[model samples]
Target: MTVELMATAEHAPHREEFAALYAQVQQFYAQQMRILDADADGGEARWAATFTEDAVVELPLLPAPLRARAGLTHYARAAAERRRRAGSRLHHWVGMLDVRPRPDGTLHTRCSALAHATPPGATSKILYVCVMEDVLVRAHGTWRTAHRRITRDDLA
Candidate 1:
């Protein structure tokens, strides 16, 4: 019994650290969705701010991965244009986050993302369901996404 108690005590701090890391990673994705789904114009800039200066975003529909702030800006502009054309209200639902700390001190996160859209005078519909894999790092004492790869769930 004493040996078991010692082992449990040794693992307690590690468990707390893991919990804290998981919460920070979850918060980062939640903030990303909030900024991306904002109703106000120019929210793309806000969304981009959540990323690192040299962040990379991989979209399933894009030909190549978007890199850095300039690439993010371009993607944001394109997304805005598409939304404007569609005239739909957009929302993102993130679920089931799995976060693990890497040996390099960064965190790897995988989560399900469900995008919904509501057209004028119409009910909301699921636009797409995707799984997002991300590498997050701590910069300036805050967690920011360094890399994000989105894979659409074809079976869904």
Candidate 2:
């Protein structure tokens, strides 16, 4: 009976499961960025679809103490709109490097990204470069960002 229980220590299968879950979550993020990039008129609608029904967004104006992911989808949509209206094109995305699971089943993720925007008659500018720190969760088998911290590197 002891010999039969020896296989319990194997973590290979557990590792595979986590990888699959991570990939699924990443796919959702990729789609959200794509929608924001390709969409001209309906970008907000498409981007909002990727978020949880009760998602929050924080702008630079918010007091640090007041910043919270307590349902700021409307504000995020408006911010996206402001960028869209000002530019001919904007592309922003990240390459994930690490993901760790929290005790509550959320994932803490780290990723590097390069963001660029080009106005109609002006040269494209690489406005921001940095790593994104995210708290992610899978709801209904889909990954949603519960929190995001943008650490921009002005020198990058």
Number of the predicted model whose TM-score against the real structure is largest: 1
Cα deviation at 137, candidate 1, in Å, is: 0.7
lDDT of candidate 2 over 1-156, digit per residue (tens) = 133222321322485666665576577668877876774665666666665665554333455421333234345566677876775678887774466666787877777877788888988888788777777777787787666666667743
- Which residue pairs does candidate 1 place in steric collision? none
lDDT agreement of model 2 with the native = 0.63
- Name the lDDT value of residue 30 in candidate 2: 80
| Model 1 Cα lDDT, one tens digit per residue, 66-111 | 9997789778877877888989888999987777666687877788
Question: lDDT score, residue 74, model 2?
Answer: 49
- TM-scores of the candidates are 0.86, 0.70
Q: What is residue 135's positional error in candidate 1, in angstroms?
A: 0.4
Question: How does candidate 2 fare on TM-score?
Answer: 0.70
